[model samples]
Target chain A: MVKSYVEYTFKNSLPPNATVLLAAPTLPIQAEGGIPGNKGIWAGILSEMTEFALLFGVYFIARAHFPQAFKEGPLRLSLFAGTFNTVLMISGSYFVANAVLAIRQNRPRASVRWLILVLIAACGYLLTKYFEFRWNVGQGITGKTGIFFTVYYYLTFTHMVHVLWGIMGLLWVIARTRMGAYTPAEHEGMEAFASYWHATDLIWLVIFPLLYLLR
Target chain B: MKAMTHKRTIGLLWLLLVALTLGGAFLGETAAPGLAVTVIVSLTMAFKGRMVIDHFMELKTANRTIRSLMRAYFYVVPLVTVLVYLFGDRLARLTTL
Candidate 1:
C-alpha cells in the first residue's frame, strides 16, 4: 500500500535520484508521508516537536502547581504584542506555503517573490518581538520575577531561537532560489523551509494563548 | 491546472486562519466564562494546527502512515494540553509519587 502510494505520487514528479533517495534505507520512508522535502528535514521536525512536547509537559506541570500564577500571569502580558506577532507569524507561514506552491507550479520567480514576503514578515515578527521584550522588561516582568515569568521566558525564547534559525534558512534558500537552483520538479529546499516555518508557526499558535490570552 | 486549484485552496485556508486568529483574540478578551473560553481556544488551536499540517504542509494527500502521525500530533497535543489545563491539579496529585 505504501509502495503504491509513493510510486503514484512521485512517479511523474520526482526524478530517478529522488526516488532512490526516497527509498534509501537510512530514512524512514513509511513515516515521511511521501517526502515533502526530504528525510533529514522531517527527522529534524520530529526532534523539534519532541523537544517542544517535553517543554510543554513541564509547562503544564508548572501551571498545574501554580494555577493562580498562570492565571494572573497573562493579564500582565501585552496582548497587542502577542496578537501582532501571531499575525506576522501566520502571514509568514502563508507566504512560505505559497512559495512552495509557486515552485511546484514551476514559477521560480513567483516563488522568490513569495519568499521575499516571508522575509518581510519574519523581520516584522523579530522587530515586534524585540519591542515586546523591551516592554516586558520595562514593566519588570523578567524571568526572575516569578515562576510564571520564568516559564513564559523559557518557552517564548526557545521559540524565538527557532524562528531565528528559520530566518537564516529562508535567507539561504532565497539565495539559492535566486540563483535558479530549484525547479518545480525538484525544490526540496523550499519545501523543507516551508515545513520548518509552518512548524514554528504552529508552535507559536499554541504558545500565544498559553502565555498571552489564557488569563 | 491542478496548481491553480491548490493556490485557491491555500488562499482560502489563509483567510480561514486569519479569521480564526482574530476571532480567537476577540474571544480571549470578551469571553467571561473561563471554562468556555478554554474549550473554545483549545478547539481553535487544534483546528489551526490541523489546517497548517494538512494544507500548508501539503500533507493532505500524504502517505497513510505519515498523514496519521501528523494528524495524531496535531490532535493529541492540544487535546492533552486542554486536559491538563482543566485537570492539572488532579494530574499533579495523581502523579506525585
Candidate 2:
C-alpha cells in the first residue's frame, strides 16, 4: 500500500520528459548576458551615478565661473585627511572585493574575515572624516563659507551618507553570512552590498582629485 | 588555485591604485596649474574609476549592454570634466541660456 502511494505521487508530480529535464543542470535565463547580483542592483547603481553626474556638472560649472575660489580652496583644507580617507576607501573596497571572491569559492569564514577588515577600514574613514569636519568648522569653513566650500561640503557629505548606509548593509550581510544564509551559488545579497560600496569608492576617487588634488 | 589568482590580481590592483593616488597628490603639490597637471589628474581619475568598475564591481563579466553603459559613464565623466577645465569660459558662455 505504501509503495503504491509513493508511485502514484511520483507519476502525478512529473511527466516522463519533465523528469529528465528536472535532473539536468539548470541553465541561465539569458544565454549571453547577466548582471552581477541582479538587475535591480545595477539599476540602482546607474541611478546613483546619474545623480552624482548631475552634481559633478554643477561643480564644474561653478569652478569654471570662479576659478580662483576653487584654486585657493584646497590650500586651506586638510590634504592629509583627504588622502587618508581616499586610501581608507580604496582599501575598504579591496577588502570587500576579496570578501566577494571568498564567498564565491565557498569559504564563508574567510569571507567574513574580509568583511570585518572592510568594516575596520570604513571605521577609519569615518574617524578621519569626523576630525576633518571638526577642523573645518573650527576654521570657519562651512557650507556658506564660499562656493568651493559649498560644493566640497555638499559632495563629501552626500558620499558620507551613502557610506553610512553601506556600513549598515555590511553589518547585516555579516550577520546573515555568519548564519550560513549564503552559499557559493546564492550570495546575491553580499555581492549587491559590495557593488554599492565599490560605487561609492569610485565616486570618492573622482572627488579626491577634484576637491583636494586639483590645485 | 583560481581563487588564489583572483586574490593576487585584486592585491596588485589595490597597490596600483594606491600608487596612483599618491602620485597624483605629489603632482598636484608640485606641478603648476595648467594643462599637464589637469590631464594627468583626469587620466588618473578615469583609470581608477575603470578599475573599480571592472574588477571591484565585476562588470567585466556583465552583459554587453550593462558593461557598455558603465564604461561609457566612466569615460564620459572624466572627458567632460577635463574639457570643462580647459574650456570653462567657453562652456559657461555656450550654456548661458
Candidate 3:
C-alpha cells in the first residue's frame, strides 16, 4: 500500500540520484515540486519565516520590554533540562540532515540509520521535557508568574509542541526509509521535512537565550 | 571533499551542550541577575544556537531563498533592543499593566 503511494507520487520523477538535491552541488537542483515559483521550497520558507515573525513580534514588542513588569521568579528551572533538550535536538538534526545527504548518495541504509537516530532523539526530547514540566509544576510556578514566566512557559511549551509534531513527521520519514521509498532526486520530502525539524530546533535556540539565558 | 562527518559533528555538539550546561550551573545564582551569570549563559546559548543553525542544520548549504530565510532569523536580534525601545513608556507605566 505504501509502495503504491510512493510510486504514485514519483512515477514520472527522476530517480533520486539523478536529481541535484541528492547530487553534487556542481549541478544545482532545479526546485522540486514544480518549476521554480510555486515549489515545496517556498512553502518551507513561508512556514519558517511566518513563525519567526510572529515569535519576534511577541518577544520584541509584546513582551520583552513591557517595562520589566515581571521578573524571573526563581532560577528553579533545571539547566539540565535545557541542556538535555539542546543536545537531543542537535543529535536528531544530525540524523535528519545526514538522511538528506544519504538520500542524495543513494544510500538507503545510511539514510535509514540517520532517520532512526532522529526519532530516538525526538523521543528523548519529549521525555526530558515531561520531567522538566513536572518539576516546574512541583515548584508551584504557574504560567501566571507575571509576563516573563507567562511568556516563558508559553514560548518553550509551544515550541515543544512543534518539536513533537516534527517527531511525527520524522516517523513518516522513517517509514519511507523502511519502505525504500525515496530515490535520490525525490527525497525532497525528506529534505523539506529535515528543514522543518531544524527550524523547530532553531526556535529553541532563541528560547534558550530569551528564557534561560537572557534572564 | 569533507565527506560530511555526521556522527563526529553530533559528538562535538554534545560536548558543547554539556559545556553550556555546566557553565550555566557553575555560574550559579548571581547577585546581579541582569548582569550576572545568566548573561554569560544566554550569550553562550546564542552561540550554540548559531552553531546548530549553521553546521548541524546546514542552513549554510541551503539554496539562496532558504539562505535568506535563515538570515531573516537574525531579525529577532535587533528586536531585542526594540523591545526596550517600544516598551520604554510601558516600562514607566508598567504598574498599570
Candidate 4:
C-alpha cells in the first residue's frame, strides 16, 4: 500500500534533520544555484518588457483621447493601502524565505515556526485585501478605474489567489515538518514547498510595482 | 521556531514599510507632484517585492526549475497588461478608456 511505502521512506529518510544528504544518490551536494541574473528570479521579466511597454503605450493613447474615465479612477485610488500591502507582501516573502533556509541549515523545528508565522501574515494580507475589496464594492466603486482599475483588480486579485494557494501549501508542509517527514538530507518535500513559496514571492515582486507604484 | 533572527528581520522590514507607506501616501497626495513621487513609490514597492520574493518566498535559494517558474509571472504581467490595453475592451466590452 502507499502507506507502507511512505512509512518506509519516512522512517529511513536520512534522519529527519541531517544537515547533508550524504547517502542519497539523487540529492545534490548543495542547493541549486543559477546565474546572478540581471532580472533576478522573475522568469518572464525580460520576455514581457515589451508587452508592458505596449500596454502603457495603449493607455497613453487612450488617455489622450478619452481622459475622463481614467483620470477620475486613479485620482481616487488608495495609495496608502497599496503601499501597506506592498510592504506586507515583501516582508512576508522574507520570512518564508528564511523558513526554507532553516531547513537547509537542518533546523526543522525552526523552519516550521517560520512558516507558521508566514502563514499568519498571509492571512493578514488576505484580510486587508478583502477589506479593501469590500470597501470598494460597498462604495459602488465599480468601473471606477475603467480599464486601469478593472485590470488592476483583475490582475492583483488573481495574484493574491496564488498567494493564498501558496500559503495553503506552506501550511501543509509545516504540518509535515512537525510530523518529522523531512530533514536537511532527504528533503525533496521541503525543497518543493520552498520552491512554490518562492514562486509566489516572485510574482508579487513584479505585480506590486506595476499595479500600485507605476504611474 | 527561532531560526536566527527571522522575527527581527520581519520586524525591520515592517518598520521600513510603514515609513515607506507613509512616504508614498504623502507623496501621492501632493499637488503638482513631480515624477519623483511615482519613481519613489514604484522603486520602494519593487524593492519590497524583491525582498519578499527573495526572503519570504525562499526563491533566493531556489533551484533553476523553481526560479524559472517564479520568473514566469514577469512575462504574464506585461502580456496581460498590453493585451488588455490593446484588445481587452474589444474582446469583452470592458474598456473604460
Candidate 5:
C-alpha cells in the first residue's frame, strides 16, 4: 500500500540513492499527509518546546518576584548585542526556509546556497553571543547578580545550547544536500532541519523582548 | 510563477520580521516601560513568532495536532507576559514561598 503511494507520488522512478525518510514510524511516506519533516523530528520539537516552557515558567516566577531587578536588567545589557542577535536569527531562519523552498522547486544548487547563508548567519550569532556573555561577566553581572540576571542568564544559556544543536543539525543537512541525498520527492531530512532551526528562532523571538526589549 | 510567488512571500516575511525587531528595540530603548510599551512588545513578539511558525516552518499546512501545539505556545507565552506585567505584585504575592 505504501509502495503504491510512493510510486504514485514519485511517478514510479525513484531517484538514485533516494533516502527513505519516513514521516513517521507507522507512516512511511509524506504523500499521505503533511507532516513537515517526520514524526521523529516533530517528537524532538515537542520535547524542545516542553523544556523551554519549563524554563519560561522559571523566568516568569523570578520576574514576578523581583520586578525591580527585571526592570533594571535590560537597561544594563547591550541593546546592540540583543538586536544583532535577533537579526541574525531571523535572517538565518529565513535562509533555511528558503533552502526548503528551493529544494521543493527541485533547485538543489539554490538550496545549497541558501543553506550556506544560514551557516554564515549562525556563525555570526555564536560570535555575537560569545562577546555578549563576556561583556556581561566583565560588567560583574553574573547569575548571582540578582533574580532578573539569574533568569536572564539561565534562559539565554539554555537557548544558546539549543542553537548549538541547531548548527550541528544544519551542518549535517548541508552535507547531505550537497551529496544529493535529498530530492524534491524525498527531502524530509532538509525539512526536518529547517523546522528545528525555525523553532529555535521562534524561541529567540520570545526571549529577545523579555530580556532586552520589554524593559 | 509559483516559485516566484513563494520567493516574494518569504522576502516579505523576512522584511517584516526585521522591521518589527528593530521597531521593538527602538521602543524598548526610547519609550518608557509601561502598559502601552508592554502591550506593543508582547503583540509584536507573538506576531513574529507566528510568522516563523506558519511561513518559515511551513507548518501552516501541517498536521492539526502539531500546528495547534506550536501556535498555542506562541499565543500563551505572549499573553502570559502581558499578565505578568499587569499584575506583577499579585503574582509575586501568590507565588511567594
Candidate 6:
C-alpha cells in the first residue's frame, strides 16, 4: 500500500539551521529515490539547459572573435535596466520557492499569496525588459548593429520567451492553489512550475553577467 | 519549526543573491576589464548559480544524477567563461575557419 506521505530526503549539506524537511514531494510519490518535481519536469529542464548551452556557445564564440566589441558593447547598454531585471528575477525565484515551501507545510493560502508575489515580480521583469529593449533601439543598438548586439539580442530574447511561458504557468498554479487543488501531500504541478521558473532564473543569472557585468 | 527555518534560509539566500548582484554591478562599472575582473565575475557567476540550483530549486537532496547534472552545468559554464576571457585569441584562432 502507498503511504499517505511521501518519503523524500534533502541532503544535509546545508547549514544545520537551514536543513530541509526529510520529506517534501512536490508531486505525487514515486519510487523512494525520485527527482524533485517529477521525471517529466526534469526532462524539460535538461532540454532547456541544452538549449541555453548552445546559446552560450554562440555567445562565447562571438565574444572571442569580437573582443573589442564585447568589451564596449555593455558600455552603450543601460546598466540600470539589467540590474533591475536581475533583482526582479531573483525576487521572483525567491517568492516561488517560498510558495512551494508554504504548500509543503500545508499552508495553501500562504502559498497562494507567495505565488501572487512571484507573478508580480515576473511581470516587473517583463516591463523592465520591454523598456530596456526600447532603450536599446533608441540608442541605435539593434541586432544588425554588430555581432555583439546580435548575440545579446538573441540570447536575451530567447530568455524573455521562457519568462513568458513561466508567467502563464504561474497563473495556472496560482488558480489551482486558490481552488485548493494542492496539499502538503500532493502539489506536483506547483512544484513543477517552481522548478521551471527557477531554471529560467538560473539562465538569467548567467546571461546577466556575460552580457552586462563581465566587461 | 523546520518550515520556519527553511523560510528564513530562503530569505537569507535571497539577500545574499541581491548583495552579490550589486557587487558584480559595482565591479563591472568601476573595474577595468582584465584578469582580475574576469576572475571575480566568473566566481560570482558560479556561486550564484550554485545557490539557486541547490536551494531555490531544492536540488541539494535530489537524485544524484539530476543534481550532478545541474551542478556540473553551473561549474562548467563559469569555468569556461573565465577560460574564454583568458584565452580568447587562441580560441578565436582555433574556431576560425
Cα displacement (angstroms), candidate 4, residue B20, comes to 4.3
Superior candidate under TM-score, 4 versus 6: 6
Clashes by residue pair, model 6: A11-B61, A26-A188, A27-A188
lDDT, candidate 3, A1-215, per-residue tens: 99998977775576756556545544222333222222564586467657765765565454435535433533657767876787677667666767777777789898988888888889899999889888888987678856666766777777887887788878887888779888876776776687788777777766665555444
Candidate 2 Cα errors over 4 Å, as ranges:
A1-32
Model 2 CAPRI rating: acceptable
Who wins the TM-score comparison? 6
What TM-score would every model get versus the actual structure?
A: 0.87, 0.88, 0.72, 0.61, 0.89, 0.90
Question: Residue by residue across A1-215, what tens digits does model 1's lDDT show?
Answer: 99999979868787768867766544211134476777788888878888888888888888888888988898788888888899888889889888887776678899899999999999999899899999999999899988999999999999999999999999999999999999866788878888889889989988987888775
Q: Can you write out model 6's per-residue Cα lDDT over A90-206, one digit (the tens) per residue?
A: 999999998988888889999999999998999899999999999999988899999889999999999999999999989999999999999887888998999999999999999
Measured against the native two-chain assembly using Cα atoms, what DockQ does each of the candidate structures obtain, in the order listed? 0.40, 0.38, 0.25, 0.26, 0.45, 0.59
**What's each prediction's clash count?**
0, 0, 6, 13, 0, 3
Whichever of 3 and 5 has more DockQ, that candidate is 5
Tell me, by DockQ, which candidate is best: 6
lDDT of 4 by residue, A88-206 (tens): 66556666656666676778899888888778778877887887777777766664536767656755666686787777777788898899887766666665555455455555555
Given candidate 6, what's the lDDT at residue B51?
94
lDDT of candidate 3 vs native?
Answer: 0.64
Q: Model 2, range A29-112, lDDT digits (tens) per residue?
A: 112455777778778888888888888988998988888999899988988899889999999999999888878778899999
Instruction: Give the fraction of native contacts in model 2.
Output: 0.65
Q: Of the pair 1 and 5, which is ahead by lDDT? A: 5
Q: What are the RMSD figures for all models against the true structure?
A: 7.1, 10.8, 10.9, 12.4, 8.5, 7.2
Query: Candidate 2 clashing pairs?
Result: none
What tens digits encode model 1's per-residue C-alpha lDDT throughout B17-67? Answer: 888888888887777738778878888888988988888887776666556
